[model samples]
Target: MRILMAGVSGFLGTRLVDLLVADGHQVTRLVRRPPRGPHERQWTPSAAQLDPALVAEADAVVNLAGAGVGDRRWTDQYKQLIRSSRVDATSTLAITIAGLSEADRPEVLLNASAIGWYGNTGDRVVEEDAPPGEGFLADVARVWEAATRPAEDAGVRVVRLRTGLPLHRDGGLLKPQLLPFKLGIAGRLGSGRQWIPWISMSDWLRAVMFLLARADLSGPVNLVGPAPVTNAEFTRELARQLRRPAIIPIPGLALKAVLGGFAQEALTSTRVLPGVLNRAAFSFRLPDLPTALHAALHD
Candidate 1:
């Protein structure tokens, strides 16, 4: 398959592109710089523009493009940038795909979203059909999902990947979790009872490929571990995996004091399950938190 992806330079994008390429698929990277590999292109998402001729030549379009939510401070402007970067890039893709001639258009569009769409639901079994939660993160995810309307309406199989925390040592949630866990100071974020939806790097990659290859699957699919562990459980597992003492509990007030609105996401429970993946006959490589944490920490 000839696959085109925007933001292939990001954490998940880079891994997804690597897997796609390794699987012998021809990947066209949409980057900000000049072409560097077998397939490379350029685009500026903030401006809502891309080379149409380039976009028109693809079997599938996987949009992993977006600004990182955790990369910036929770300032109003940064928050808007986070929302616009995703919504705009997706809007651009959907619109461009809609503009394509029938014969030249891509067959499927696997767009990236977040599990944050469910917000802080404590222990509730949220699925694709669940009503979106309310708040800043939820708002960002809502608009992100809406961005793909044009593509879906144009008859493209649009799959919104509501991703969970990916366990990658080089980057992602693991990087931040490392220092505290390694130093034996890691504890539950707040009370640690908040459900932290997560997926191993291996499972994340495999599940994405599963989604890409499947024909009947579309709409919102949660890219989360089937076993949604609580923050306390996560802390204990991670500490045990790293041979550290899980002490030093950080209260909700401290988290809020330090990170403000961002702290709510960390302190609240998003008890999400991989309802779509399981029903679609997909299997996870690392289904347990202990094993996944060990591999992530060891690597």
Candidate 2:
């Protein structure tokens, strides 16, 4: 399959590109800078600019473009960037796909989303059908997913990937914690009761490939593991894996001071389940936290 993707330099994107290439799939990257190679095409998503012909050449389009939510402290400016970065990229692709002739449009669009859509679900388990929750990330996710309507309405199959925390030593949820955990200074955040819907990096990559080929599936799909763990459990397991003592717990106030507006989100309990993937009979190699963590830390 010929796949045109945005945000190719991101943690997931970089690995996805490699996986696709290894599987003998043709991947075209939409880059912000000048074309570095034949596989890359320049696109300015901030300005809603993309060549329609680029969209015309692919069997599918994978949009992983967005600002990193945890990359920096959430100042008002940074918050705006977080929202705009996702909305603009998604809107650009959706609108571009809508403008194309039916025959010219790609077969499907796999747009990146997050489980943050369900704000503070507490103990309540959420699925793809759950209603939108309240919070900054929720609001962004609502619009972010909505941005794909243009393509969806234009007869293109659109899949909103409401991804959970992907476990890996390289990036995502596990990277930052590795150093502190290795130093035996890491512990749960705040109350540590919040549920973390995490997936292993290998499973995450596999799920994407599964969804890419599953033409019958569309709309919101939770890309999380079957078992969701509380922050306390996560802390304990991580500490055990590293043979570290998780005695230093960080207070919510400290997190707020450091992460700014993102602190509340960090403490959010979104117990999301991959309902769609489960029903579709998609198998997960590492379905539980222990196996997922071991694979992440070891591999």
Candidate that scores best on TM-score: 2
- Which candidate number would show the highest lDDT if scored against the true structure? 2
lDDT on C-alpha atoms for all candidate structures: 0.87, 0.96
TM-score of each: 0.97, 0.99
Query: Clash pairs of candidate 2?
Result: none
**What tens digits encode model 1's per-residue C-alpha lDDT throughout 1-299?**
99889888898988888899899999999887777876788787778778888768899999988888777568888888888889989998999999988888899999999998988788778888898998888999999999999989989899999999999788887788788888887788877788888899999999889998898999999999989888888888878777889899998898888787687777768989999999997988899898788777675
lDDT of 2 at 119: 89
Residue-level lDDT of model 2, residues 148-196, one tens digit each, is: 9999999999999999999999999999999999988889999999999
Off by over 4 Å in 1: 34-38
Q: What is the Cα-based lDDT of residue 4 in candidate 2?
A: 98
Task: Give the distance in Å from residue 173's predicted Cα in candidate 1 to where it truly belongs.
Answer: 1.7
